[model samples]
Target: MPRFMGFVKMEEGIGAPPQALFDAMDKYIGEQSAQGHFLDGGGLFGTEDAVNFVVRKGETTRVDGPYAEAKEVVGGWALLQYDTLEEAIKGQEEFAELHATYWPECSMVATLRQVADEPPAPAEG
Candidate 1:
């Protein structure tokens, strides 16, 4: 089975979503969990309190967010596994549909990307 990393990208500072959407999402997540497609993941807080450690020029520097340039951020994520890409696409479609039906006012992107089986080489000092 191939693994996928699913992300929900939405504009920053939008405040909380509607209760109906949350209810629908709970149901959807429950179904996916029962079916074994939903792995480990959850929603995230806004970037106002986010932190980053950037590596540049052989040095790592810490940066805090509430970043001025950030337009969109990941609202939620999921680690999913499916037998094929078609199956994964179908799953993502159902998820997107739930959002479309329950949270029609929001603008967001639902991304499903295959995860690499192997990690990249370590960076040299």
Candidate 2:
């Protein structure tokens, strides 16, 4: 099975929603995990608490945010293991559907990236 990292990107300036929204998402994710589609996941706070570090040459400069300037920030993430990309896509579609049905006022984008497997150790001669 291939593993993937799925994340939700929330539009800037949107504050956290009511606990009911979180409860809905948690229930859905919990069901998936029980079915083995979800490995682990959690939500994140708004970007006001973010810090950005830019490294130029060997020097690192840190800037504190109001990441208000960002267009979108990851609001949550999940790890999934699937037999194929199609299965992963279908899973995300279902999740998005849940959001559409339960959190219509929310604006979010969901995306998935495959997790690379670790390489085998070099042969010992």
Alpha-carbon TM-score of each model against the true structure: 0.90, 0.81
How well does candidate 1 score on lDDT at residue 106? 81
Native-to-model Cα distance after best TM-score fit, residue 97 in candidate 2, in Å: 1.3
Highest TM-score: which candidate?
1
Query: After superposing candidate 1, which stretches have Cα over 4 Å from the reference?
Result: 120-125
Clashes of each: 0, 0
Q: Candidate 2's C-alpha lDDT?
A: 0.85
The lDDT per prediction is 0.90, 0.85
Q: In model 1, where is the ten-residue run with the lowest total lDDT?
A: 12-21
lDDT of 2 by residue, 11-40 (tens): 866656767767887888888888898998
- At residue 113, candidate 1 shows an lDDT of 98
Could you tell me which residue pairs clash in candidate 1?
Answer: none
Q: For residues 1-125, what per-residue lDDT tens digits would candidate 1 score against the true structure?
A: 79999999989887688899889889888988898888878999988899999999999999998888978899899999888999999999999988889878888999999999999999999
Full-model lDDT, candidate 1: 0.90
